[model samples]
Target: MDQGFFLLFATVSVITALMLVVARNPVHSALALMACFLQISAIFVLLEAPLLAVIQIFVYVGAIMVLFLFVIMMIDMREAVLQRFLPGGNLPALVLLVVLGVEMIVLVFWSDSFSVATPATAGGGDTIRTLGTTLFADYLLPFEAASVILLVALVGAIVLARKEPG
Candidate 1:
């Protein structure tokens, strides 16, 4: 992976994640979340996992984000309460951020692991074909479980969106 592009995607991902947390409007927050997901998918591509990148875009950004937007739209936004920012509320997050920064610096400057280049595709058939075979053959149960969970979540969202009986 190219260091320059990785750094750019990482920076954008972090900024958009913070924006998602801080946005006053729920819709804006969802939009920021989508931006963050896109940046993350780009980072996945940089890591030479195009399958993961496509899944990230389609699953999280396409389907899940649309569900999030629908939920946000169904809610009464006018009745939403604004939270007051306490001065000390973010201390734990700040500490974790500092630790993450130190870890990144150490990884970039001292680690030899990143010096090695990995092949873009694993074990030789077409990338998508290999992925499909592996997923359905080796990981079928887990994949089906994930799909069921997503289906349940979708049904729950629809339930929540339905009008209440008077």
Candidate 2:
């Protein structure tokens, strides 16, 4: 039962991710990205991380996706959508994708690191409290860095969307 749900969520996530990359319209791509994020949240639920699942849906699907759609709406994408790709432009990407897929398969099948292991028991404390403490204490730098990166991206989008006065 759990395995079936996991497979369903994982497959939808992969399909939506592919749609996000291949969709020509920026709005469609953003919608696909939102679908991918929802599928990922479902996977987090299957993994018994309800808090993470909620955060995924709230942060990625709710807040970040809204921001993405706002940016997409602000930009004029007609030229971008109508642009032609250079001949065989995707060949290099296809080759890289194939190589990475083969490498991942080899790693999954042959690497001892992927072997099943005993699951670790949760620490004897409030899970959310522990997570908050760890995030602010141990991983504070990375957390703040990610926030700064997001801030920069938001500002960049605003600047790009601004109309220039003649």
Candidate 3:
């Protein structure tokens, strides 16, 4: 049962993630992203972590997606953004793709001898208690600093975009 669920989840996640990247329409891409988030929340439920699943659904699928959709809909010039093309043009894109292919080949062949080992952590599943503890203890200052920085950046961007009197 769990294996089947996991496989379905993985397939949905991969398909939606690809669609999110490949979809020419921005609104469709955002919908794909929302699907991805919902699938991830379902995976969390399958993992027996209800809190993470709730957080994933509420924070990512609900609030974040609504905000993104609101912003996307607010944009009257989405066609212009969609029609925008890459710089250095088609030749550079093809060359870059070739370089990426070579890099992928190198990574696959050269890294054959190296194997990644998982870290030996005691608790595997995420818990709200532990998450809160770590957030308040080890990462408290940095998290607070990041919040202030994001607030400042938001304010600055708004200020910069504001029109001046003629």
| Predicted structure with the largest lDDT when compared to the true one | 1
> TM-score for all predictions?
0.68, 0.78, 0.59
Relative to the unseen true structure, what is the C-alpha lDDT of residue 127 in candidate 3, on a scale of 0 to 100? Answer: 59
Q: Rank the candidates by TM-score, best first.
A: 2, 1, 3
lDDT of 2 at 148: 100
The candidate with the higher lDDT, 2 or 3, is 2
Q: How accurate is candidate 1 locally (lDDT)?
A: 0.84
lDDT of 3 at 116: 34
lDDT of 3 at 95: 82
Worst ten in a row by lDDT for model 1: 76-85
Give the winner by TM-score.
2
Candidate 3 lDDT tens digits, 60-157? 88886876676555554544566667766767756876697678657755874424323223384645677788879999999899789857855664
Please give the distance, in angstroms, between residue 142's alpha carbon in candidate 3 and its true position after superposition.
Answer: 11
What lDDT would each prediction earn against the true structure? 0.84, 0.82, 0.73
RMSD of 3: 6.1
TM-score attained by model 2? 0.78
